[model samples]
Target chain A: MPFKAINILLLPLLLLGVMVGVWSYIALKIPGFPTPSEVWSELFVVLSDPLYNNGAGDQGIALQLGNSLARVFGGFAIAIAVGVPVGLLIGMSKSAYTAFNPYIQILKPVSPLAWLPLALFVFKEVNTTAIFVIFITSIWPIIINTALGVRSVSEDYLNVARVLQLTPFEKVFQIILPVAVPFIFTGMRLSLGIAWLVIVAAEMLTGGVGIGFWIWDEYNNLNYAHIIIGIILIGVIGYILDTVMGLIADFFDYRKRGRV
Target chain B: MSLKTFLKIDHVDKVFPLGGGKEYVALRDVELEIRENEIVSIIGHSGCGKSTILNLIAGLDTISKGTILLENKHILSPGPERAVVFQNHSLLPWLTVYQNIEMAVKKVLGSTLSASEIRDHVMKYISMVNLDHAKDKYPGEISGGMKQRVGIARALSIQPKVLLMDEPFGALDSLTRANLQDHLMRIQMQTGNTVIIITHDVDEAVLLSDRVIMMTNGPEATIGEILDVNLPRPRKRLELQHNEEYLRCREAIIEFLYSKFAKDDE
Candidate 1:
């Protein structure tokens, strides 16, 4: 084989070896930290009976993961429903953007963790509070990116709309939305990542059946192996979510036509 | 030719604001009258505001002074009656060539025609521009010349009262440009639509236009000369190369651009 092809095949293996070596060194130094073998065994035992249910508050890893996923998707769907239209309006109208921009700017930077206390106080329910945090955390990128996308629609396309005498509704549906799809998808991709990040943190605070809570429970029991498994699970799930989002974005991407 | 004026530009001036309470004058006292079924080409050097004049007529830009009248009515904003073939061939990249034309046809004629009728109408224009084979192809998949053909088809599908072309073939290679020019001549002959083309090519102005409106160099550009091309219709590109009248018309435009209004750098 050529040197370049051999390098490509070997590079990933080398990186994996370095990661395992560093992890093993940390496990040895920290004393309580689970080693790679310990975590692998725990992962296998956990996977063998994933959907087991001892009772309420004590369930399998699958149940915790399902709960977390449900909250994330619910919050994400609501955010998209509200954010996209609001963004379209803000982008299409200069006066609306000017009027609403200050409020968006002020509210956007507040952390989702910061909203958790207020949400818990108001909703008084762990599940609703967790979902609220996800909603608030994921909404800003969608709205801001969508607004920017709508605003950046090419003048050439809008000129075509104007020349065609397209109605305001037609302008949005036909030209603005289609042209802005890629940018909106970019925003959605960012928002989904944020949603996943926020859900784990929110679930940890709310003391619920979620991956975040699972990690906290494992930590409380001093089961270091399970904690390591939870971390790996969260990482894998987040990767899967991002990959799915990317595939959907690629499917709708008009700009990548000839290049793809 | 009939004497009735279909479109009139009277004493028009365009001033673009350059911030800090200053403005740049692009066009001044640009007056012209276009008759029904006439092909008028506006040719000038860069920055001569030939495009400004075309935009004013298309109602794509606002005139600082004077008025543009189409069929004795003020042209205030762009409407379906005036369709433009943009310089870069602005085919929506997401839409296929067929959908691009279908969009224009559906918007203007959808209320009058059934779905099948609309499809047939769009296909007629697609074939007229010789893009039937590539109708299903997206703009990104097509060549520059084919994209321009889609632009032309999209513009004509609307059945506009006047078709406006802004350097439609300027971005293509010489060969593709010549091919499109021939296609345009044939299309114009078949439809008899009033056309106002903006171009920098002298031969393009002579071969396609009934009258070429030559603009002087800018700071404030106005029509410098109007040369009438008395060549017969259905003119062939091969035959026009040897035709004395075509050569004389082409030379007149060349002399105007190089000698009368040549830039200091050129």
Candidate 2:
């Protein structure tokens, strides 16, 4: 094989091998750490019957993953349903932007964990608190990005709408929505990533039937191998969710597709 | 050739507020009367408020002083009656050529026409601009000339009373500009719609207009002269190249622009 092509093909595997070597060395040095093989074996055991039901507290990996995804999607949908219209209003009117910008600026930088106490106090239920955390974490990116998108719409397009004498509703649906699609999808993609991240953290705190809770439970039991497995699964799921959103963003990006 | 005044711009002035209690006068005492089916071209150097005039007539910009009336009614705001073909051929990049034309047609005539009628109306203008094969292509996929053709098609599809063009072919190359100018002439001849074109090209102003309204330089630009283009209709581009009347009209506009209101830098 040519040197460059071989470098491209072998570099990632080489890196992975080095990582595994380092991990194994760390396991040998540490008393309670799981080795690569131990985690691999535990992953197989967990994957063997992922949907296995063992009552409320001891569900299989697949069911836990399902629970995490359900909470993330539920909170993310509600965030979208509220964020987009509020973003449009803020973006369209200068007054609304001025009125709301202070709150957005103050609230946006706050960590989702910071909201957990307040959410738990208000919601009381563990499930609602977890979902609230996801909602609060994800909503800011969506609102800000959507507003930016709407604001960045070319004046030429709006001039076209005005000259055409399109009704206000028609202007929104036909012109603004179409032009803002890429921006909206961009916001959604960011929010989805944040939602996935926040859901795991929230579930860990709330103690639910999710992957985060499963990891916590494994830690309490001193099953370091299962903890390693759970960490890998979370990373993989987060990567898959981001990739799916990227695909959707590409599909709707008229500028990239050159259809617009 | 006196005819009924189809549109009137009476002593119109435009002042843009620059904040801090200061203002900029873009145009002042700009008066004009456009007869029915008349093709008028406004020509000037850059920053001369020629486009400001077109925008005022199209109701895209509000007049600071005086009134603009079309068909004996005040032109208050932008409406379907004055369809503007913008300088950059602002075709919605996301929409196909057919869809772009169909959008204007559906918006203007959807209430009065059947679905098939609307489709036919859109297709007629699309074919009028000789863009039948390109109807399915997006604006990004087409050449500049083709995009301009679609812009014209979209504007004409509405069957507007006055077709307002703001340097419509300014972005195209010379050959493409000539091609669109000819296409515009042919379409105007067929449709008999009143047109007001803003141009920097002297030949274009002479070739396309019945009267070329020349403007002075800006900050307070006003009509310096109006050259009557008495060149006959159904004029051929190749034939008119050596024609005396065409040369005369072209020369008059050139003299007015270069000699009468020549820029300080020139």
Candidate 3:
């Protein structure tokens, strides 16, 4: 067990060392690209007063990240509110599923960025358009996964509900929701991931006060080290979001409880 | 002693659609009359439609061509009056043992009984199944036998007129199966609840039932023979090992399943 624990720490550190070696080589070749030490110094500077606001475009890294998060969450919350009920409606009835499935299939694979121009024209505002793009990117998984969760409810559980003569409302709350919650969380997790992924690109296109926009602004100003720092920050924050989502999903999952 | 006919199944047929203008007949001309407070076991090989019969009675499945009446009331849809103990011990995995039983109690008796009465009612059945220690434990935490005990407890807690158990102990190991069988017998004796159990186990049928209803193999299955298990109640597994009636009942089921209507593929 102790050996396994050592390997867990050692193996990743070994990979990181190899990656930095490759990165440093690339930086030397590229001339303007930041080396590992340069990016490390920039990270310290960026982390040092993350919430400073020096007008709209010159906000601190934390403020930029906070704005991106606000837009992503705004879109994500709306997607959940709309997606869950629609998914449940489609899940419980064959007619509803038949009506909606074709459109879902057609629309799901279309890129969220593809909708940006239309959203920009419709909303006539940058933040609204960014949030709208995040919504588009995040909604498909929520609807599809939530529906999958409802369909995955066992016949045995439904039989118990029927035998008890549970009212439709009681059945949905006491039986269906409990069974579907884990699935809904799975959807939400996926939705949040896509939402985060799209927010960066959306902010870049919209010229907004967000992490994506800041990264682009740094690139334009030729402060290449800050771009690398931004990449690391985004990666770390996305990892944290995914980890938190996973923990929440496990909490609601009945299969995870008491069985290892 | 003459007993009142509590539940009746008349001329039932179950046919499944085979997609392309064809159908598969699962059961045909299925008939049964279960007495009040009596325990009946429907035993057969796999695909014998014993479960279909139970499903029909429980009103979980619609009858193709027949009527099922519990106390002369037509069984149209599933209700709290006919609670089922499923083969998989279908206790809601999310709810604890107490809460699982409590959900049924609250739903069935919620209007008639107050909150305190409901709590007492749930506790009564949980104790009846001897799962007091595991009351707060979730279904996934307990052993298979204990889960089935909770399943039985939940079914009984609803105060159903007929308890329908579809292969309730089939999933458990033999030792656990025996333990649960003993638990079931004790509970049934105390409550005097009418139970119709679907089983493929010949020994289980003879041991737990007042009458073992043997079913023929399907493509149109029906009750083949009804063997009377006249062995006295509070039947201990050890004592029944050498009892004449017990052996006779076991032999009849084996003979019916193996000799008269055995499945060639099996």
Candidate 4:
């Protein structure tokens, strides 16, 4: 019943929805589950409203969404660009791997939220604070994945390159890069997911116009329905972002004989 | 210039230094002269440095003593002039059959052919190895036999004067091994290229070589003897096996090895 071979998950989901509806009805006789209709209508108003309504300072939902994307992308791009090359260097040399791995290990466990106060104190800009959180949150996965990817290259490939008298640049570009691509893409996907997750939490801690602050403000206004709606939106968007990255990673990993 | 010596291995010796002061003598005072278009097969037990000699010829490793001159020139490093087909084939796993062949061909023959011409040139050698059907497949998608074919095709595509094979068929199954042996002989006879194959199988050496060089076991290893195989050309499998000349040469090599080593019962 939990897993239908026919992908009949909709049956269980529908049953769960009905159970929630029946439970809401029973709760209506008592107190506060904010009927399903309340949640939906609240989501509808927030999505369609021409004004911010929640004092996001005149920026609508669409504008806030775009701003959030720009901040996340800027930080995520920096993480990938810096992390992959450093990882490749570490992967190729035992000395470098030994020296750098411990530093990364030490830094990796420190949460993005832990960086929040320092970021606020030093950066002094809301966007920069969010960006720092994202950059720190996403970098380790990319670096670790890239290093693992580079280390996985076969000795046969190395021997062939050696026999062919491949220049170091040519060897790295033609042989090393193509073989390491799957690992790099895997790292990128992980970093992108982490960046998206971190930004939401960062937004909540540092009051801004992002979806996180919107949800927190809704709770402050005693509008629990809008808060639930914001949570659903955040979950849905995060899922979509992860799915897109996953598809891209799969495409690169399986593709044969492509450019270096 | 007579074809008496295309390569001269003058008193070559390789000593591998194991850590903590232990030293292993891999080869000692080894001398060899390979002629043009001659198929010289070397047979030996494991740890005899048969592969060490091949790597030295390819300049993949430095000799601790002695010199190897290819076409009367000193070898400094691996170049396109002497192409090698290794035992494991060492095909780049990411490339298709066509692209793997194209790699060496592209580097050596780049100025000689245009872009489309290089494609045709690569395809010609792939089909020469009977791998036209597996053109777009990666090495991992192919069998062990097919992967070795790709290695042969890659080496041949560069059109090197000497083709150095190091126990290439040793890793293959018996049936595929036999099939490849036939394929190799047919190609060698057709091209008339000089080749040096290293193997341990008595029959394989007898079947493939113009001369078989039997090597002694190491402490300080050296060539035991060289036996010329005078079996007729365009060799027939069933006929050659039964021929007196072939049997006489085969028995001579077997007897010589047994007498030299531990064939006391014979």
Residue range A1-260, candidate 2, lDDT tens digits = 55798788799999999999999999999998999998888889999999998897799999999999988988898999989999898988899999999999999999988989898999898888888888887789888988888888888788889989998899888888887878988999999988887777788888969988998898899999998888889899999999999998988888888453
Q: Which one wins by TM-score: 1 or 2?
A: 2
Estimate the lDDT of model 4. Answer: 0.82
- TM-score for chain B of all predictions: 0.98, 0.97, 0.98, 0.94
TM-scores of the models, in the given order? Answer: 0.95, 0.97, 0.95, 0.88
Clashes of 4: 0
- Quote the positional error of residue B46 for candidate 2 in Å: 0.8
Measured by TM-score, how close is model 4 to the native structure? 0.88
True contacts kept of each: 0.73, 0.78, 0.89, 0.41
Residue pairs with colliding backbones in model 3 are none
Model 1 compared with the native: what TM-score? 0.95
Compute the lDDT of residue A13 as modeled in candidate 2: 95
Question: Model 1, B173: alpha-carbon shift in Å?
Answer: 0.8
- Per-residue alpha-carbon lDDT of model 3 for A1-260, expressed as tens digits? 35787899899999999999999999989988899999998889999999999898999999999999999999999999999999998999999999999999999999999999999999999999988898888889999988998898899999888888888899899999899999999999999998888888888898869999999999999999999899989999999999999999999988887572
Going through the candidates in the order shown, the clash numbers are 0, 2, 0, 0
Give each candidate's interface RMSD in Å: 1.5, 1.8, 1.4, 4.7
Q: What is the lDDT, from 0 to 100, of the residue B115 in candidate 3? A: 89
User: What ranking of all candidate models by TM-score puts the best one first?
Assistant: 2, 1, 3, 4
Task: Give the DockQ (2 decimals) of all models.
Answer: 0.70, 0.70, 0.73, 0.32
